[model samples]
Target: VLPHDPSMRPVWMMRIGLFLYDHLARREVLPASATVDLRHGEIGQPLKPRYSKGFAYSDGWVDDARLVVLNAVDARERGAEVLTRWRCADAQRAASGWQVTLQGPGGQERSVQAKVLVNAAGPWAAQFLREHAHIQDSKTLRLVKGSHIVVRKLFDHQTAYVLQSPDRRIIFVIPYEGEFTLIGTTDVEHNGPVGQARIAADEIAYLCEQASRYMRQTVTPADVVWSYSGVRPLLEDEAANPAAVTRDYQLELDTRAAPLLTVWGGKMTTFRKLAEEAADMLAAPLGGSRGAWTQDAFLPGGDLSGWIGTAQRPDGDFQRFEQALTLRHPELSEPMARRWARAYGSRVELLLRDGLGEVVAPGLYEAELRYLHEHEWARTADDVLWRR
Candidate 1:
């Protein structure tokens, strides 16, 4: 955390939280937090001289879109039909189960009878219940738009900086795509449609101004190359501030007729646990097993066969895996090979099994595009560029 004007509560509170966190959990992957002299090292070099003292902490990052795609792939491999670009237009209680009308692209619709219905839509959970299922929900969703901006690389080091703004909020400046710095996120109240979320001009200026406070290099709105925003469906707790709203989720099961599970206000970090609990809740009603099978299971493309490092130290394993991937595909460029290995993990072999086909773009090839379309349900150019 960065140093601010007068109050040190944020820093001290962070230290105390880190202390409790280090003692509370089995921290085998990342190291514990510590006090650091930012003036002496690369971490401090990027910041202004006035901001000399700070705290350092560790956290892991994940490709969220890739994680969702991999989960779908794992489910499809386990005999679950994974459909993309499909929506539940209508859901009604049938004699045996739920009579759901699924609408697809080109205005085509299909009907399916599901024993149990799960409304796991992120921001549209309440809307789905009200509009499609014709059920009114008592709970409210406070839509908060979190915006982020990407700019040219700021610091040379790989360490991410968590800057405390004058408003007491924190923004992260992390390395992105090996060429840019990803900075974000503003939690502003959003009243527009969920899918229409876009980074506002003011949000961009705010991020740039906040980030420029500490960094030696001032961040300006002109420096931002790209920006995006997502509306968070947070559980409304009547908090006066949008940022103060709770992120925890609630699972509501309506067994009035057929079982309908409505998942409300959850972040991606606790998705697995939420899914497990949701499954367990519906297990008895659906006559399915109640075992927590996903607790020890690996997501698709997560297994590294020749891994030499434990869960605590997995960096070396991936480095070695990348090396092996490069060795196998000597014809591929080092950057391309490493990107594929990082993106697909051990499943890179499956991606390259058919051999690299025609070059579709500068770095993108036809084989990878085909694999994404066939396996990851990628259809549009935006899907390929932004998602897979």
Candidate 2:
């Protein structure tokens, strides 16, 4: 789920929440809501809204929180070779020239002769070396489990709340998409594969209890619409509380056998920075052709000539730039169009390739699909539905 701020939450959560509040909210800012009711009715907090509902946009709008799909989509865009279900490196040394052993779509096999190689397989970073690279005594990475609970929207206001749980862990009541409030994030030690992770029932109860403090409504397991769990591969730190563990990333390089770089403790929001660093390290060994350049560069659709739209002051001087994109392109509704604008930034104009012409398609088109398919390696429809 997205967070209202990044002071405590992971960087990725902040990015998603910032994007949502920027384009979706009519007021352009999330207003704080005060609770008036805290009682739990017979069936507990009402399961569904009793009255009719209205929407700012149609159902199934894009920009939902689905990081897995978004990452896959981005990996494809950056021309990175991605393997879905891959095997361990097995501690074997890669041969000199570029080697390619095609197994199946489920696995990946490639050889690299770089001055540096990055191992960012989440929990499997240590295991990759233990099994494949013949590197003895690999550093430890303490795994942590973070879980979230999804429930019906808790407030009429468009803003999300970043509440402090009793345990001092933070929980967010974000306006997820349009229908539900996404809450969660409890960090505990993990001892299993990240893929096998699942949210525990107690975690749900804990989240509900914590949320009940700031909210007027009482949430429970029954009120939960959905839940998710993920494993964070954190740098081994002896901190007492998992919540207090450092969120910064660390890198280790071993030039003994071949160059082996292992990554630990990183989040989705910082992936861009991580990737650029990895590229710079690998470039020297792979033949340095380009210098480091990413911080200021815009992502796929983020290029803007000026900061979006401008407003005039009483004296006709420019004062502010509000989102009036819908005024120009009537094809997209305010929210969806704005989603494209913020997520893609100035790049939204590229989606309007025809330029001031009618929109031939409502949602996605063939050109877009082909671009994702060829450049982005989008194997499923969810990649576009969730990430694009």
Candidate 3:
């Protein structure tokens, strides 16, 4: 976090917060937060000269789309029926369970019964209950649209910057996709259809303005190569400021008749914990084990013990695995091998077991495309391009 001024109050407050965060848990991989002189280092090169000092902290980022795909794959491997391009047309509570009518592509419909129904439809959670299940929920969701703009790479270094705007909102300037920089996120109230959520002109200008405040190279709307927006279904907490709204989630389990669990709000950081708690809540009604098991289990392709000689840390294991893969497949280039390793991890073997048939696109092969189609439910070119 960077201080707008040299005032002692903001710096002290930040120090206290960082101290608490550093000692909050046992951090094995990341280092503790510390003070840094931004003026004399590469970290401050991209920022204006005014940003002379800031506190350096450690955090991790995830490929959210890939994470969801992996979760679906893991669920399928565990005997769960995974469906895509399907929606619950109607759901009625029965004495036995929930009778659900799922509508699929081409106007096809199928019926299924479930002992419990989990409404994790994100922004559409409330809508699903009201329209599909015909349930009147007192609890509501505050849909906040967050927008991000990707521009040509702003900095040469890998370090990400968290710039505090004059309006008290913080914006992240992070390296993205090797060729672009990602500057984001404005929190504005969304009152439109969830599917129609798109970045507005004002949002684009706001992002550019905030990003330009810190960057030596000014950002403008014309400079934006791409922009995306999504509605966050935040639990209505009555906070006047959209940014002050809590990111915490709440689970409402209605067992009055048939079990209906509705997930109100959540962020990616707490998804696993939320899932574990949700599972525990539904276990008693569904007559399943309440024991938690995901903590130790690796997601699909995360385990590299099968290929690596030593069972070391995940980063080390992955590096060794990538080297071993490159040695085994001499035909694969350095960039292609690394990309496959990072994308599929140990599961790249499954993709390569059958020889690469054709070059579908630059750096894209038929083998990988087929793997995604068969395993990850990638149906179209857009799905493969965006999701995978």
Could you give the C-alpha RMSD of every candidate to the true structure, in order shown? 1.7, 9.7, 1.5
Report, for every candidate in turn, its global Cα lDDT versus the true structure: 0.87, 0.59, 0.90
TM-score of 2: 0.67
Residue 11 displacement in candidate 3 (angstroms): 1.5
Off by over 4 Å in 2: 1-91, 94-102, 106-115, 269-291, 306-328, 346-375, 386-388
Task: Tell me how far the alpha carbon of residue 328 in candidate 2 is from the true structure, in angstroms, after superposition.
Answer: 4.5
- The candidate that achieves the highest lDDT relative to the unseen native structure: 3
In what order do the candidates fall by lDDT, top score first? 3, 1, 2
**Count of backbone collisions within predicted model 2:** 11
Q: What is the TM-score of each candidate against the true structure?
A: 0.96, 0.67, 0.96
lDDT per residue for candidate 1 within 1-388, as digits (tens), equals: 4444345456667778779978887687778878888769788888888886787777778898899899999999999997788888999998899999999988899999999999988899889989999999898899999999999999777888988876878899998999999999999999989999999999999999988988899999999999999999999999998889999999999898999999999998899999999989999889978588887787887778644344434787788878878787897899898889878887877778889999998899988998898889999899998898
lDDT of 3 by residue, 1-388 (tens): 4534553348778889889989995678778888888788788788789888888888888999989999999999999998899899999999999999999988899999999999999999999999999999999899999999999999888888887777778899899988899998999999999999999999999999988988899999999999999899999989999999999999999999999999999999999999999999998999978489898898999888878866767667778999999998887889899888888988988898888879999989999999998889999999989988
State which candidate, 1 or 2, has the greater TM-score. 1
lDDT of 2 by residue, 1-388 (tens): 2112223455455446555755675442233222222133222132222211111111212343433545554566778667654544444445542222334555656543434456777777777666655455546778889999999888655545556454556676667766788887888788877689899988998999877755657887899989988888887778888777778887665556556667777876677788777776666556765876766554454334364434223112111121545666676766566455545545455556644344325656564565555544567877666545
Candidate 1 deviant stretches above 4 angstroms: 1-12, 306-312
Worst 10 residues of 3 by lDDT: 1-10
